[model samples]
Target: MMKMNDVAKLANVSPATVSRVICHPELVSEETRSKVLEVINQVNYKPHIVARQFRTQKTRNILVVVPDITSAFFSKVLRGIEHVALKNGYQVILGDTENNIEREKDYVDLLLQKQVDGMILLTARQDKVRLEELSTQFPLVLACEYIDGLNVPTVSIDNVSSARKATEHLISLGHTKIAHISGSINVILSRDRLRGFKQAMMSQNLEVESSYIQEGDFKFESGYHQMMKLLALEVPPTAVFAFNDEMALGAIKAAKDSGVNVPNDLAVVGFDNIKMSSINEPSITTIDQPKYEIGKKAMEILLKLINNQELHNKKIVFKDELIVRGSTRKEIDVKETLEMV
Candidate 1:
């Protein structure tokens, strides 16, 4: 019920001054802005968001399309995006595609129709033709995931290098019989991680056994099932590397159910370093991608695109860190490594 005019009168300032104080506080004088803010707080004044949107021709709404909302990997990223967006007086609308191309496309269409000012996508599965067409009409930035050979602006970590580091950690831990639990091969991150896995094996003069690698859908259940298959192999792996923390946790559960002693019998490592990783019975060793920073940077880039500002490149790659924990003990040395088929 509080009005801007009432605040302006109480502050003894003109309505235009009050408008600047609310919309562009930085442009107003410190003393005047302070007075207006005091009156605003005293009256519990609320801005008419709808009226402002109508006047500014901006919805102040951004759509974030994620592959899965339930994954802890995305929770920090969303927090970062929300932090930056709220500070800039914008709102975020979230859409979960569940890694389904059709669902992704549907959300894209719906957000477009809703006239959101910009969009940040963590699922970039749209066909090249469609993506090119959409990019021409709207401000869009890809986050976490990206389409190969596309010019869309993206924010993500160096997947290949981080994955290689993870594998190398296992190799240095006296484990040559290292198996990999890969995510869906179609995703770029999955392919990159697989490539890194092979590269690490070859670097150490170890044989790359195709049978030692299994594919999962990046889900706990898929990881559980794939790990079971790995355990049943005639020559079981001495250590396993999962594509993400969620899968690694699932694999850990499977290992426990089969009475396998972690690290002692089978070392395990995961990626993404989700919060749960540290709290697991045997804390997981994994790669930590700056999930929150990735989200914040993606939104910052999209905001620039919306304003038609020049961006140096369409691709932005973030750095990753390898965090060692109890799941992969550091006491073991390379001299004790076993030879594999």
Candidate 2:
């Protein structure tokens, strides 16, 4: 029940001096600061955070827009975002859009209404005009997904090049009959990855079969179903490159159910090396995206924007690694890894 005035009286300082000591200590003399701190400890006073935020016109809350919260790959990224946000004295508000445009707009409204300080968008919405307009209006950063025309700061890997490297790995292993399972065609990353797969195939003088390319929705179920269709082909593919780990695992399961031996009869490669990929029956060979690093870097850039600082780069690309595992070649024993766990 102690107020700022009460602390001021105990410290024998004016109310304004007490306010300066509490909110902006650098503005007050060190002697005055010491007296205020001593009195504050005796009173055990806590600043009213909400009232302070209102006075400064800042919520100190960041809105992170996610396409799907259940995604294992995204979970790591979210952990990174939360870590940076907390360390920087800011709070994160997750906006799980579930790939819904209406829900995305709702989060945008929150930012426009001054409910949050800034935003980091993980969902890649195709509304270029809207995004571009918003970029000029407020502090915005895109992580894991991006649009070309927008001048907003973005943190992402080169999807096309990463996909190309994965496909090339399969080709180096002498796989001529290679198939591709891509995320939805609407997504820019999906399209870039598919383009990379095609580039790798053409480099080896192999035919890019129409029947071998399957479009999926970046879900486990879709991966399973699309893979089944690929398996049903008259001339089944010897290797498959899936867009994500979730879909890649699904493809592997389908191959097993159909009595196909993985890496022996059918080799599989996937993007986004999520945690589950390492412990699965056949540890998946995947493109290792720096998921946590991406989130950390994105939040860092958002903070720069929030502080009205100039950014060095608007489009930031991180490196990607191709990890070889049992799905492509024997790496670890599933039973042994499980036992270690």
Candidate 3:
């Protein structure tokens, strides 16, 4: 509640002296700095975020745009972003765009209008050209998902490689008729995942049936419905790979309803080792994407940009791990943490 002037009055110093002590302690005499600190501690003085923003031209706030705030996968990332921002004296403002382009644009306005100092996008809804333009104007970074040819800072795992790893796990179980439940092809990650599944399938000289690849919206209901469709086929697939954990869980439920035993009759693999994937009836065998680390790295990049510092690298890719659980093969569930710095 105490103002800088009040602190200066108590310390027998000018306001500028107090400012110098706080902003650049190295430039201020140790005696002056000690006096100001003693007064500040006595009064429990705190800097006004708004006033500091006015002086520095920074909001001290970050905007994080997420496609679905309810997603547990993104929740981990959000926590990672908040952990760094709050530690740096900045608060995070979360915006849920619901995967709607128009809604996303509305939140992007906050960054364009300078309501937030910088922005971190956790979803992939922005156009490539628009992202390029925004990067030239604002401090922006992409997390979890990224756009190709944008040259903007990005932090994510290799979707294609992760997907291939997941599929290869299923293939190692000696399942030849492996099916894929894909997320929306509109998103590059989804396409990359599908491509990986195909790549793994071809490596084994297995045929990819067009009917086995069902399009999903990265939702549980969509996964369940798609699994049902795959099951109804005259010759159903022996195994399935889902792009996300939610979809993978859905597929498991659908298979159970169809009187199929998981890992025994139909092996299922999922991406994004969300919390639920481990506790589910059949623990999911998934690719750990290091969601939390990715979030933290994205915010770190945004901070560098907001400070007008040069980036050592434009793209940051994290490695993913394949976790073996009950969903794919019946054994002692072995969990692997996706550790990336």
Candidate 4:
């Protein structure tokens, strides 16, 4: 293993300067920084992360807790976090809560016992009172999901505004009887999205009928079942908006199985523009939350907090995009004319 002393001798700079180059490169002159980097690369210098952690009282390890690791939505976020963490010479430890409050609490306790430098949380539950107590001892960041009034730093999209935009898009498409399928209402994301949906409908002078709204667990099966129930309503909705892409896909599947022609008999829109949404038949029109960027930004914030650096900005909000596709189309004439031309 190449030591900092060897790099210092090779670059003719102090070991402290070498450390500064590795950790705080901006403080050193560009010429000196480049010289130290060149020597580091030549010698394949690998810093002793454990020793550094012990000396600095930082583990240089961050725990990222997700509700479900299998979801494609979260996988993209994980990739983003990994990119930033690896670049910063920090290690990320994953904790999959499976949406279980007890399991989430257990993971938090374990990570704290291990003395991790910080934590990035996606599975924030209302029962995180214990975790809140732990934050007094260590830094914590909330990603994707937030706990209202928690005073924790968070990185997320503006769910309320984006959901309103999505609903307004449907309204612009001449959909008056728009329905909504949502995740658990207890979660902040779900509550905000639901509020947005209602606000959009109310703004347009459209009644938000409780009978048209369905609740799901943000799962494919939950979506499928909920859509089936909605389809059985006395006055079935002509359009439906799902809180996430998986639910939207599930609704599509249910509509097809029920012999309903999509965008003709039904128009479906989803959130979180996951990859499958674009590839699915009649491709879903959905809100594109920058999942990967959210993950990366969250990790970046966590790393800064872990290093005890001043975070110039505490809350980071990513923008959302609306992707139009065939699933929500009400007319083929415009598309046909464009294609012919």
Candidate 5:
């Protein structure tokens, strides 16, 4: 019931002084601030946040665009984003595009309409021209994926190199007949990871068999189907590499359904070491991407852009780690690692 004017009148200060005391405390004299605080406490006054936002021309709401909200990997990343956003007095709005470019564009329209302060995209599907144009007019940061020509800041690990390292690990373990379960070819990340897999095979003089490669939509069902197809092949792969832990877990299931024991009969590896990777029946050997850090760092970059600060780097690439687990432990001779090359 108590309003700003009522507080000012009770404190014997003008309304403008009261506004300054509430919005910018430092702008008010100490005496004026103390008096206003006493009145505010006595009245239990609550500032109108929406009105304040309107006056300041800032919603203090950040939009985070993700490919899929159901994916555990993106959920983990969102936790990091929420941590940073909350600590800095901002709110986060999630936009799950479900890998649809048109849906992603709809979320971008929120930024253009001043409904959100800024945006952090997790593997954006929008065209380069539109995204580039938006970047010039808004604060935008890319997380987990990047486009080469866009000058917008990005936070991600090197997908190609990480994929190469993962493939190399399988090769070192003497998995010459290796099959790759790749993500959708439409995204740059899938293409880069596929390239890495091929490069590693080439370095070891292993043949990259076309039949051994399968395309997945980065879902558990796709992984299950692909693994089944691979198992039915005349010359089945000794080991399988999946683009994500979801697929890796799927492959493990398919191998078991076919009465095959993991790591013994068929070795399997995955990328994006999500929480389920460790808790699975046979834990997956995987490329550990810093998912949480990527989200946190992406929000940090977006904040800097919103504050009109110069970014130290346009592209921030975090390092990926390889975690060996129970999923792929078929050991081979150390000398064979050399022989394989």
Candidate 6:
């Protein structure tokens, strides 16, 4: 109900002085600031955010493009992004691409339309040239997944290294016949993880069997079905490493359904230490990617770009930890599980 002019009129000060007190408090004297604050509180005056945005050519909002919003993995990262955005006096616009390139393009159009100030893509499948062109003109930050050879600022862990370590953990537990449940090979993240799994196997003089590897789509159903296929093998793998938590959880279910106990008959390890991984029946062993910190760092990078601040660095990679859980433990004897099966 109360505009800046109304407050200015009541306070007997010019609108510009009121603006100074509200927008640039340091420009106004302490006495003036105190008086304007008193009147603002008394009249319950609220500045028009839309008008401010229009004048400044800034929406004070950022877009976050997620490949799949339903996954808890992204949700935690989003929380971190939101935290940083709010602290910096900005709002977040979430765009769930549903793993569809077309949907991601639609969201990108919002940035081009000036509907938002900037964007952070969690996973991208857009044309390389187009993305490169857009990055040159806009404030875009890629998180978790990145395009190789592109200088786009990114925040993520070393997927390949983490995956290798996960497989090495299984090997350390005396699992000779290790299987891999891979995410789609199209994405760099998946490919890097697969490469890491292979590297670990080679380092230990273990044979990376083609029959033991199953392709998944980074989803529970795919993981479940793949694990089922592995179970039917004449000589099933003694351990399995899944690209993500959902797939790993599915593998656990599939193993149980086939009368096999996890970490006993079949050790299971996964990437992304999602919350469910810790609470699952036989809790999953996984690589703990700093989900929240990744989001926070991505947002911080985007803000720096938005404000035209000099970036201290372009590429930021976080470290990951391999957490040992029930799923990969040796407490349950393999012989006992085999006899039960």
Among these predictions, the greatest TM-score belongs to 1
Listed in order, each prediction's TM-score against the native is 0.89, 0.86, 0.87, 0.85, 0.86, 0.88
Q: Give the Å error, residue 254, model 4.
A: 0.5
Q: Once model 3 is optimally superposed onto the true structure by TM-score, how far is the C-alpha of residue 178 displaced, in angstroms? A: 0.8
lDDT of 6 by residue, 92-152 (tens): 9999988988999999999999899999999967888888899898999999999887778
Off by over 4 Å in 2: 2-50, 330-341
Q: Residues 267-335, candidate 3: write the lDDT tens digits.
A: 999989999999998899999988888888998899889888899899999999999999887543445
> Residues 287-339, candidate 1, lDDT per residue (tens digit)?
99999999999988887887789999789999899999999884454566543
How many pairs of residues collide in each model? 0, 0, 0, 0, 0, 0
lDDT of each: 0.87, 0.90, 0.89, 0.86, 0.89, 0.90
Instruction: State in Å the error of residue 289, model 4.
Output: 1.3
Stretches of model 1 off by over 4 angstroms after superposition = 10-14, 17-50, 330-341
- In model 5, the Cα lDDT at residue 192 comes to 92
Q: Model 4: per-residue lDDT, tens digit, 1-341? A: 77899999999999999987766554689899889888998999988877776666656677888998878799899999999986665678999998887788877875668667788889788465765776666788889998776767789989999999999999998999999999998788999999999999999999999988999999998889999999999889999999999999999999999998898889999999999999999899999988888988898788777667788877788889999998898666788889999
Per-residue accuracy of model 5 over 135-244 as CA lDDT, tens digit each: 99999999998887787888899999999999999999888999999999999999999999999999999999999999999999899999999999998999999999
lDDT of 5: 0.89
The worst-scoring run of ten residues by lDDT in candidate 2 lies at: 19-28
The list of candidate 3 runs beyond 4 A from truth reads 5-50, 331-341
What is the alpha-carbon RMSD of candidate 6 to the true structure? 4.6
Query: Scored by Cα lDDT, where does model 1 land?
Result: 0.87
